[model samples]
Target: MVENAASATGPSIATRIGKLDLPAPTLMGSGCYGSGEEYAPFVDLAGIGGIVLKSVTRFPRLGNAPPRLVATPSGLLNAIGLQNPGIDAYLENDVAKFAERPCAVIGSVAGFSVDDYAYVTERLAARDEIDAIELNISCPNVGSEGETFACDPGLAEQATRAARRVTAKTLIVKLSPNVTDIAAIARVVEAAGADALAVVNTVRGMAIDVETAKPRLGNTTGGLSGAAIRPIAVLAVWEVARAVKIPIVGQGGIENARDALEFILAGASAVSIGTGNFTDPRAPQTVADGLRSYLAERRIASLRDVVGKANPGFAGVR
Candidate 1:
C-alpha cells in the first residue's frame, strides 16, 4: 500500500483498511485488553484505530488447565484455549459497552466449524458498534481431523466465506504461522471474500519444567508470542503482502513503535499490540505516539507513505 512521497501538509495519521477507517494504525490485539475496558483507564483508546476483543466461542470455555501460561526469554507461551463467556452472555453483558468506545470495535470470533463461525459473526453483525469482525480461525476444526482452520487453505476459506456471507462489516481473517506456506492460506481466504488479512498469528512452541521434566504448559504445547516471534511474523507479513492485494494487520511480539514500524515496512497497513500489553498497559499509546514522532522526524505526513518501503527489491508497493 505504499504510495507517493509524503508532503509535510499531507493527511494526518487517520487511515483506512478495506471498509474500516481509523485514527491510526495502532490496534489492540485480541485477548489482550478485553474490549479496551481495562486499558481505558490507562491509555487513550480514542487514539487507537480499534480494539480486538477476546476470542468468543459459541459456548463458554473453561480454557486450558492451570499453569496454562509461562514466560520465555522473549515472550509468553500460552494455552488459554480461548476461554471466555458464551456468545449469548457476551452479547447480554459486554456487547453494549462497545457503544461507549471512543474508537472502532473489532469483535474476535473463534469457532470449531463453519456454522459456528457464521453464527457468531451473524450475531455480532447485529451490533451497530462492532466495526469489524476478526475471525480467530486458529482453533482446531472438528470436521477437519482436528487441524486448525488457519493451517489449512480449504478450511480457512470455508471459515472465511461463512462469516463473509453473514456480515457486511469488514471481515479480517487471522492466519496462523504454523502453516508451511502462509501466503497460500492468505490468498485463499482473500478469494473467499476476506476484506483484510491479519497475517501471522502465534507460532507453536513448548517449554518443559526443569524440576520434573514435564511440560511447563498444562496443555503440553502453546503458541509462542512476543519479540521472539516478531521476525517470523514480519516474514509472513512480507510474503502475504506481496502475494495478496488485501490490506494486512501485521502482529506478533510488537513491544514498541520500532517493532510496529517493522511490520509496516513489511507491508502491514496496520499493526496490533499483543504480549506487549501485559508488560505495559499503555503500550498502544506509546506505539501510536512514537509512530507520529517517527513520521514527523522523517517529515512524512501520511502513514501510508512508509508502508512496504522496506521490502527488499521492491522500490515501492503502490
Candidate 2:
C-alpha cells in the first residue's frame, strides 16, 4: 500500500535522505514557509512533498532591530537573527496547526551550544508530525557561536553528532557559504553521522548607507540570498555532492523551475526556495510545476536522471 501511494503520486520526485524518504524533489525552504500558515493562503500545502519550518532556537529571539530586510538586485538580505517563538511554543502551537498537511514538516533548528541543539532535537523527537530536522549551524547574523560552528569542521561535527544522539529523526546539517572550503566541512559532518547536507546557506554580506556612511542592516552584516548567489550555491552543491555520499538539499537564489533544475543537475536530490518566496508566494508550486514540465518536455521519466548530471567529470567516471 505504501509503495502504491508513492507510485500513484506520479513519476516520483521523492528521494531518500539518510533513512527518511522525502516525497518529492521540491521542499519549501525554512523561513519560506513561515510556520506553514503563511502558505495556506497562497498554495495547497499538500501538493509539495515537504515544508521545512522556520529556524527555531531554545529560547525566543526578538531578532535584530529594525531594517531586518533589504532588497538586492536579484536577492534579499536578511538579518532576522533567528527570531523565533522558541521550541516549546512552536511544538505546542505551530507544529499541531500543520500536523494534518499531506507534506512532511521538517524543523530548522539553531543553538548557542551543543546542549541547546540536543535539547531542541530531543523535544522535537517526541512529536510525530516532524519528519526531519535541519540544523542551522550556519546562521551568520549571530555574534559568536553560530558563525564559529559553521566555519570550523570540528565544531560542525560536534554540533551535528550531538544532535544525532538525541533524535531518531533524519538530521540534515545546513551549511554556510562563508567558509574557506565547503567540501572540507561536508566531509566532517558526514563522518559525524549527518543523514544529509543542505548546501550553501546565505553568503555573509553587508550593505552601506551612503548618507549616514553606515551599514544598512542593524546587525551590520547579513546573509545574502536569491539570484545573486545561485551560481555560488550550485558550485558549492556540486563540490559537496562529490565530497560526500549523503544526499544534498540545495538552495541559495532559486527563483524558478529552471534554477531548481540547475541545482538538481548539479547533484541536489532536492531543492528549496528562499528569497524567491518573498517575491512570489507561489514560487514553490511554480518551481515544482516547472520541474514537471521540463521533465516531460525533455522526455525524461524520473528526477533521478538529472541528479548529478552536470558533474560528468567527477573522478572515476570514464
Candidate 3:
C-alpha cells in the first residue's frame, strides 16, 4: 500500500481553512453522518479532523416524501429537502453532543431568505461549540429562492455578505453546479467575505420508473452524488480554486483515497466524502489512509505541496 510521505516525517495534515487551522485534510461534509448519534458507534469521532453537521434550517423541515433515495450506477440520487429538527432543537439537542467531540464542529445552516440566513447564522455564532458555518444556498429541490440565489452572482454575494455580518466564525459558502459560470459565482462569494468555498453541490438529476412510467423519487428531481460525479466535481473544484484565493473543500463521489487525492491534485485544499459514506461506513478513514500512502509513495511532504498543482495546466482553458 502506498503510504503518505507526510505521515512518516513531514508537515502536519492540520492546515488552515480560512483563518482556522484544521487538524487534517479530511472533514465530514454537511449531511454526511447525520448527528453524532449515528456516527459515534462506527468510528471514533475524536479521531477525525472535523464534522459538519446536517443542514439546519430556520424552522423545522419535513424533508421530502418516501423513495427519497435510489442507487444509480456508481452513486445515488436523493431529493431530501433540507429535512432537519430546526435550529433551536438542534442547538439544544444535537450541537452540544458534537461540540464535546475531539475535532472541530462545523454547523451547516440553510434559509429561504436573508433574514433566515442571518437568524440561523447569529444563533450558531453565539455558541462556542460551532467552529464554523457552511451556508447552504444551493439546494436545488427547495421551494424557496435557494436555487435562484446560488445561480445569480449578485444574489449569492448579497446572501453571503448578510451572513458574514452576524458571525465571527469561519463561513464557507457552498456553491451550485447548475450555474452558467461557477468561477464568476466563486468570485462573488469570496469578495463578500466568505472564508472558504465548497465547490459543486450535487448536480440536479432525475430517474424514472419505466414500468410505472413515474418518477423514481417522490420529489421529481434529486441531487446526484457519488463516484459518478467525481470528474465533474474535480473540474468544478479546479475552476473555483483558480478563480478565488480562498480554501476550497472539494467533494463529489470520493470513494477512496486516490479519489480524494485527485481532488487535492485538482486544487482542493481538503476533501469531503458524501455518498461514499453510505456504501462504506468507514469510507472517510480509508480515504485518509490512502492519502497518506499516496503521499509517501510520491515522496510528497505535505498536502499543501499538491493543492492547486492542477491549476497551472488549466489556466489556458479558463
Can you give the TM-score per candidate against the true fold?
0.92, 0.94, 0.93
Q: How large an RMSD does model 1 have?
A: 3.8
Two-way lDDT contest, 2 vs 3, winner:
2
Q: What is the C-alpha lDDT of each candidate?
A: 0.83, 0.82, 0.81
Roughly what TM-score does model 2 have, to 2 decimal places? 0.94
Residue pairs that clash (backbone atoms under 3 angstroms), model 2: 226-253
Tell me how many clashing residue pairs each candidate has: 1, 1, 10
lDDT for each residue of candidate 3 in 200-233, tens digit (9 for 90 to 100): 7889899999999999998889889988888899
Stretches of candidate 1 exceeding 4 Å from the true structure: 1-11, 140-147, 312-318
Return the candidate ranking by TM-score, descending. 2, 3, 1
For candidate 3, the TM-score is 0.93
Model 1 clashing residue pairs (backbone): 226-253
Off by over 4 Å in 2: 1-10, 313-318
How far out, in Å, is residue 162 in model 1?
Answer: 0.7
Candidate 2 has an lDDT of 0.82
